[model samples]
Target: MDFGVAAEDEAFRVEARGWLGEHVGAVTERRAWERALGAGGWIGLGWGEGGYGNRTASLTQQVVWAEEYARAGAPPRCGHIGEKLLAPTLVAHGTAEQKARFLPPIAAGDELWCQGYSEPGAGSDLAGVRTRAVREGASYRITGQKIWTSLAHEADWCFVLARSEAGTRRHQGLSFLLVPMDQPGRIEVRPIRQMTGTSDFNEVFFDGAYARVEHVVGGEGNGWRVAMSLLGFERGVSTLAQQTGFAQELARVVRTARETGAVRDPVVRDGLVRLWAELRVMRWNALRTLGSTGDAGAPSVAKLLWGGWHQRLGELAVRVRGAAGGVGPVAWSASAPYEMDADQHLFLFSRADTIYGGSDEVQRTIIAERVLGLPLEPKGDMG
Candidate 1:
C-alpha cells in the first residue's frame, strides 16, 4: 500500500496544522489538555467539519490530525475513554438511534464513557466476565463489580459487557449494555489509586444497575464479538495516537539532555540512543498497522514494543538528569527537580502500560498462536 499521503490527506494535514497552531498552547497537564480538547473539538476530530472534523475524511486524514496535534504538544485522545474506545465501538455497533443519541455528546466532549468489560475474575479472559444483567420487564438489573475501570469516576456512562444468560457457554451468554452512570442504583464508582499516587482508575459497583432493554448495543450472545471489535480498535487505532505522543516525548527528552550537557556522558548517550532506536521502530510499526497493510498481529507487536520503550525512555530521563532530578517541585516548572519528578512519575506509570491493555505476555501469546501459527497451550486443570 502507498504510505505516502495523497493530495487530499496533505490538504487535511495543512488544515489541521493550521488549526492546532492557532488553538493549541504549551499546556502539558493531562486534565488541562482534556478541557482544551473538549473546547477545541480536537477530542473528536473525525465526526464532522463544523466541529474541527470532516466525517467523510479518510483514515489518513485522521492520522494527520493525530500527528499534528501530538507534534503541537496536545495530549493524546486515548487519555479520554469516551472519545477513544467506546465512541468508536458505538459507531460500529450502536443502532442509528443510539448513534444519534450518543455520538454527538461524545463528539462534543459533553459526556464521558468508560469500559466495563473487566470484572474481578475476568481480564485477559474477557469471556469469563460474570457481571449479570437480568431482564426485568422493561429494564435489566445489572449486579456485579468492574475493576480497573479507567476514569470511571468522571464518566457519564459505561458500555458494559454482562452475562444475560446463565446456562449458556461463557462467550455465548454475554451482551453489551450501555448503562447510564448517573441513574439511581446504576453505578457506584470507587477510586483505585495507582503506583503513581493518583486515583484516575476506579472500581465500579453495579448494584441493581437498571438499564433499558434498548441500551444493549448488539443482540444477546454478541458481546464477545463486539468486545473483540473494540479491542482491535483499541490496540490498532489508539496506538497510532499514543506512539506519536511518545515519539514527541522522546524527542523532548533527547533535546533536554543535549541542552543540559547531560549527553556528554557516555552511559547517558548510550541509553538515549537505545531508546531512540526503539522509539523509531515503534513509530514505524504503529504507522504500518494504521496503514492496514502490515501483519494482522502488528497491533500486539506495537503494544509490546511500546510498553518496553516507555519504560526505557523513563529510565533514560532519570539517568540523564542524575541527582539533580529529585530535588524539584512536583509541578511543571523550569527547574531540574520538576523535570525529574515528571520522569519519575512517568517511569512509575510506564510499569502499567504492559499490564493494562492486555499484558505483554498476552500479546506475545497472541503473536505466537495467530501470527506464527504455534500450537495452543493446553488449559490448566482447575480441579
Candidate 2:
C-alpha cells in the first residue's frame, strides 16, 4: 500500500519530464513527438521479452512516467489506444504472427488504432451487439455501423466487436477483429460535431469491409472476454496521466475565481475547496486501485469518480467566469461561428462525460452486480 516514489523512480521521473518538455507540442506536432518518443524506447514499456518495452519497469516507475508526461503538458497522446490498450492485449492473447506484425508498427508510432465497440443498439449493453460478420473464403466481410467511435477518421486500424454466429445473443457469438480502415468506398467516416464545434468523434460505416482470418484476437466466439480485457487496459497507468490535465483545468478555474472576485463569494470559495480536496482523493484512489490488476469493478469505480468530478469541474469553471462565460463570440457564420473560449469548451464538452464511454447508470450497475454480488437488474421482454 506504500505510494511513495522510490529513488530510482525519481530518476526516471526526471528523465521522463525532461524528454517530454523538449518534445511535447501542439496536436499538429504530435506525430513527430510520438516518433521521437518511440525512438527513445518510451512507447511500449511493459510487454515482456523481445518487445520494445523495459519489462523490468515496476508499477511505481510506470506511474512516475505517466505522471511526469502529463505534468510536462504533453499533448494528449495520439497513440494511447494502441500502446496502452491494444499492444498489451496482443501480448496477452494474440497469435505469434499477429504480435510480430502489429506490435512493431505500433511501438514505432507508425500506426494508430481505434475501438469499434459501441453501436447504435449495443453501447453499454455490449452483449446486444448486432453488427454481423460473415465468414468468407479466407476473410470475414464486416457490414454494420459503429457510432461515437473516437478518432475513427484518423485511425489506421480498428478492433471491432461483431457477431460471428447468427443464432447467438448477448455475449455469445461475438468476435474481436482487427480491420484496416483504408478500404476504398466500403468504409465511411463522418465526424460527429460536438458542442465544441470540433469533430474528434465519428460515425463509422462498414459496408462489406473485410478482415483476414488471422486478424481475429482471442479466437472467434471469445470476443467478450477479449473486449473486457481491453476495457481493463483502458483504466491502466494512463489514468494517472489523464488526471494531470484535470489538475491544470482545476488550477485555471481557481485562478479565474481569484481574478474575477468570485473568491469573495463564500459559496464559490467552498465549492473550489471541495473540488481540490476531491481531486486529491481521486489521485490516491487511483494509486490504490492500480495494484488490483484485472479487477472488473475497479475500472468502473474509477470511471464513475472521474466522469462526475470532471462534469462538476466544468460547472465550476463557468461559475467562476461570471457574466463573461456567456459573452463569447455568438455569430454562427462561415467566418467565425461556434468560437468558444477554454471555459466555454470545457462546459459544453463535459456535458457528455457521463453519457459516453460507459454511461453513469451502466457503471453503477457494474459496481452493484459485480462488486457487491447483487442480483441482476431485470430487463424488458424483447419478444
Candidate 3:
C-alpha cells in the first residue's frame, strides 16, 4: 500500500520521460496523435515487437509510461482499442499463429481494432447477445449487428462475440472471433454520430462474415471466460489510462477558468473545488485498483464513480465556458482549439459515459449483488 514509488520506479520514470521528450511532440489533433504513436513505440510501450510485453518491468513502470505520455501532451494509448484491450487479450488467449498474424500491426499501429460486443439487443446484458455464428466447413459464417462499436468505421479488424451454439443458456455457447473488416461481402459499418457531432462510435453489421476457425481466440464455448478476462483488463488498465487523461483535462480546465476570471465567481469556485476533490478520490481509487492489492470488484466501482465524475466535470466546464461552450466551428489559434474545448465537446460526450462499457445502473447492480451480497433484483418477464 505504499503509494510512493520505489527508487527503481523513479529511474524508470526518468528514462520514460526522456524517451517521450525525444520522440513525442505536442499534437492536439487526435489523428496526429495516433500517427505519432505508430512512429514511436510509445503506443505499446511495454509490449514487445511481437505479442509479448516487457514482463520484467513492474506495473509501476507501466504507470510511469502512462503518466509521462500524458505530461508530454500525447493522447494516452487507450484512445486505441488495439493497444488497450485487444493486445493484452490476444497475448493471453491468442494462438501462436494468431499472435504472429495480428500482434505486429497493432504494435506498429498499422492496424486498428474495435470491439463488437454491444448489439441492438444486448449491451449491459452481454450474455443476452443474439448474434449468431454458424460453423461452415473450416470457417464460421457470422451474421449479426453490433452497436456502440467505437472506431469500427476506421478499424482494420474487430473482436466479436457470437453465439456459436444456439438454444443454450445466454452465457453459454458463445465464442470470441476475430474478423477482418476489409474482407468482402462480410462486413458493413456505419458511423453513429453523437451529440458532439463527431462519429467516434459506429454500428457494425456482419452479413455472413466468413472467419476461419483459427480466428477464434481462446477456444469455442470459452468466449464468456475470455470476454470476462478482457473486461477485467478493460475495467482495470484501460480505465486507468482514461482516468489519467481525464485528470489532465481537469487540470487544464482549472487553469483555463482561472485565466479567464471564471474562477472568481462563487459558483465557479464551488464547482472547481468539488471537481478537484472528486479527481483526488478518483486517482486514489484508480491507484488502488491498479496496485498490487487491487480487487476484481474495485473496477466495477471505479468505473461507476469515474464515469459519473467525468460527466459532472464536463458540466462544470460548460458552465465555466458560458457562451463559448456552444459547439461550432472555431477560429484556429496557437493553443488548443476552443471548439475542442473540454467543457463543450467533453460535456456532450460525457452523456454516454454511463451508457458505454456498462451503464452506471448495471455497475451498481454488480456491486450490490456480488460485492455487498445483496438480494438480486426481480426480473421482468419478457414473455
Best candidate, TM-score-wise? 2
For model 1, residues 273-343, the per-residue Cα lDDT tens digits are 88878777776766666746447688788878888889888777666666335432234455543343566
Q: Which digits, one per residue and each the tens of the lDDT, describe model 2 over residues 1-383? A: 67788886887888877777776763357676667777877878767676645344677878888888878777777788888889989988999899999998888888999889898877778888878899998999999999999888889999999999998988789999999999989899999997788999899999999999999999999999999888878887888887888999999999988888888889998989998998999899998888686576988888999999999988888887763445432324567668777887888888898988799999999999998999999865321
Model 3 residue runs over 4 Å out of place are 26-40, 43-51, 54-56, 76-79, 291-294, 323-340, 379-383
The order by descending TM-score is 2, 3, 1
Worst ten in a row by lDDT for model 1: 47-56
Q: Please, what is the TM-score per model?
A: 0.86, 0.94, 0.87
Name model 2 segments beyond 4 Å from true.
26-28, 54-56, 323-335, 380-383
Model 2: residue 36 alpha-carbon error in angstroms: 1.8
Look at candidate 1 and give me any clashing residue pairs: 48-53, 328-337
- Which one wins on lDDT? 2
Write candidate 3's Cα lDDT for 142-177 as tens digits: 999999998887787899999998776677899999
Evaluate all candidate structures by whole-model CA lDDT and list the values in order: 0.74, 0.84, 0.76
